[model samples]
Target: MDHYAFTLVNGVFEDKVRTDPNNRKPPTLIRQPQLGLKSYFDGTSNPCDKNIPQPWDRLRDYVDVLNRESNEGAKYKVIFVLRHGYSLHNYIEKGVKKVNEAGEEVKNDWRKGLKFAYQKEVSLEALRGAGCEIPRVLEDHLREGDPNAAARVSLYDAALLPKEIALQIRGSEVTNNDAEGLGEQWLRWVAEDEFPLPGAIYTSPLRRCLETTKKVYGPVFAANPKKHKFQPIIMENLREKGNGDACNYRSTTKYILDKYPNYMPEPDFTESDEYEYQIQRAENGEPTESDEELEERMRKVLKDIFDDDKTSVVSLTTHSFSIGALTKVLGNARILDEGDITAFLVKAVPL
Candidate 1:
């Protein structure tokens, strides 16, 4: 079976490393348990086996293949991972009232002391007076319950409304829109200098990430028209962390608790099992396992990619949480900090 090894470093992949000869730095080998009979086969086993191979053996075989096939001449192939650009959610928190089926106000658990219906009506009127066209669908959704209604309104329709009201809301901000410049720089660095681009590009499903990818890649494809044949793969594994219901209490309360330690009431002097249960649920990937699930999903995607010798060079654009999980699964110590990019390179070898 063909062995493969890969490492992600600073947004570039190093498929094969050279020994200094005079000062040889032996190749690093990583080995872990194989789940079944494949464990006894040694590092060179059939790739088609359905059983899980030890992680270390997988890594060693990956590297060994590159060494043999290239006669020691192969350079590592880098894969870039990055977070999407900035967005309005970072700046302001605006509230809209939720209305029941009867069009009556329904108080949100997270937002207390605010009228559930009147606030949105007043805000909509204010926006209309300021030259915004409040979409009936958006208003209806706000009155009802729609997960992506807020995002859609903020991105495409907010501009039609009042500047002051819009100013109070948050929007995504792209640093640069020139795709050609970014693509040129990336190509030059990767092809000529053999250096990885400073960062990988990963984005959330939101409009901001899509916009960022379009702008950054536009110029690169423009300059090298042929390379335009390749496009990024959007993986659900790279999505944001918030997921809750209409009460709004789930995500917001957690955020508040994390931010202002003293805001919530002190733990009751009499602790109950329920208290521990709640805590455990919060810590045990409750509310949303999107990040963890994404990591495992990405691992499978990569495993398949490594199995194919013809596949070389690819990019993944996704969100922060997904990137963090991916980095950890790849053996990195911590999650990716905001706006950071990480790269990796994989090598294939005949074990």
Candidate 2:
């Protein structure tokens, strides 16, 4: 496989939008097409420029120019990376138990959530003493009390919380009232801004991501009658950084196909979670799929996208950990909130 250096095209967004974690504002491009300021690709006061109706068109034209002027083995693409909506794993990560559809707490202790034990402050020795894995830990007491209990297993390929189904659906609605133009309603603004529809969509195989991709993009593609069909390809490497948690674990390819009959997974996709049973961590300073490994995996996926898809715009429905690696691979550090949709230009140069 080859590697590419991914560079972000800056000055197209507000400084705080990507740089400031404290900025609670959702980074939607509808209202601020050029971020309410002149972009590096701002149009000149010419007749052609004056005729353009939207700033997004100018931005698209700029990306075209960038690709045209770039050297060989280099291209510019606009990618909209959307984090999956709030999931059961997210709720459990905050130490909350699973809730039933009737708004009552699920007393099934076996369905408890997992923690990021590897990233926790505790030392590895301490974790080992407690027979802990990076993302999944079998506490000594639990092991001693009941070795085969359901709680021993973390969330199995976590699904979205019930309320998020409504949240994302509502967010997708277009609003005619300007007063209702808040950031949380991202899809509305996306439609308003005339953001280019993704020529290709690549999603993680996790249930939450699969569900988010369908719910979010189904309407997006439906509204555009002439656009390509809403056919998302489930790529295995697009999964989150594995932490040995069942949430990061994915379902079998057949199971996914049965659930989402329309999804076209990679030809070689297997019937089981390929990476679920692998060693998630390295000891004695050995190499593992932690920091560098995650970046490398993201690079391969990006390379595949660049090589296989000729689309100017691409969409990805993934998780925060995967996005973290992706942004790093793209030379970005911005983090996305749950259900947040962000777009940026990527300059990929083969290395």
Candidate 3:
């Protein structure tokens, strides 16, 4: 069987590892963590707590064990590490309200127009003006003792409050349009007629990542209806930093920046209690593992995947820090700087 793996890392694929089965014991396949555990975003100060080892850490452990087990002349290999694609929320951010030089709050054009139209059409003055233009119609519409006129007036008044508020609220435009466009280009390149290999796909559970996967795989699946069915495995651990807190809108980089501007250069991952605990352990020469330890962990994970002789191909979909950390650990510090679609190929024999 042809083994191929493609991982989405830091908005692109950084490496691809493959191996052909040979005259050796088949390597064990390492199972990735469940999607639910990977995606959980508890907002404790240190998100990487004792109860929650970082995803990278878990991946590393798996790799280390695999390497140790395959010391008996087994071949190990790995392929493509990648980052998830742009998200819907990224687009939404572009449309948030911003103050112009005049200090006037100007919302997105669409929101502004919607607000203005709602206000103008529902104003008491508007109805009065309409009455003057259609006196006979108003008289005919409102019977001598009917309450329709008063009801209409009350409805207009009620709408006025919300309409005024909505005018102040800003609207958003698409933010990651460029990123998505680039992603599409990369997908096309990989699926060319002469493309080298068959590949598997994986991704983080975030909307942006899924959207990217869909865009990239849609055409492939269309062209090869039976051959290229994109099976995306959503790994929660691959999500962006602060995913959990950001989802609640209570504690996020944006929320913190808006609320506590003075805390610039936000504290390291150790700013959280869980991280602090790990730091304390490290200080004592007994480091506790946490998400902050993703880089080191990913190395082992990759190594383990490589050592698995049975699996020749695989792919991962992760995020920026995780991708950078993993690539750095894999002796390719410069890979972090490579643009989207960066790919690496590695071949190793049992040591």
Which digits, one per residue and each the tens of the lDDT, describe model 1 over residues 182-264? 44555554455433222223333334444445545545544555433324333323444333211111122344235323222
| TM-score for each model | 0.42, 0.70, 0.39
**Cα displacement (Å) at residue 338, model 3:** 12
Model 2 C-alpha lDDT versus the unseen true structure: 0.63
lDDT of 2 by residue, 230-250 (tens): 889999988887756557778
Which model scores highest in lDDT? 2
The alpha-carbon root-mean-square deviation between model 2 and the true structure, to one decimal in Å, is 10.1
The TM-score between candidate 3 and the true structure equals 0.39
| Per-residue lDDT of model 3, residues 1-351, tens digit only | 113232322211222322224422212112122211232332212132335244433333433344456444433233545544433222222223221221223333433333322231233344433221213323333333463554232211111111112223312422222334534554454454223222456554444445455555556555666655555554434444432222211123344335333223212312222321222222222223444566545654455455432444466555555665655554554222111333443434433
Candidate achieving higher lDDT, 2 or 3: 2
Look at candidate 1 and tell me the lDDT of residue 91: 19
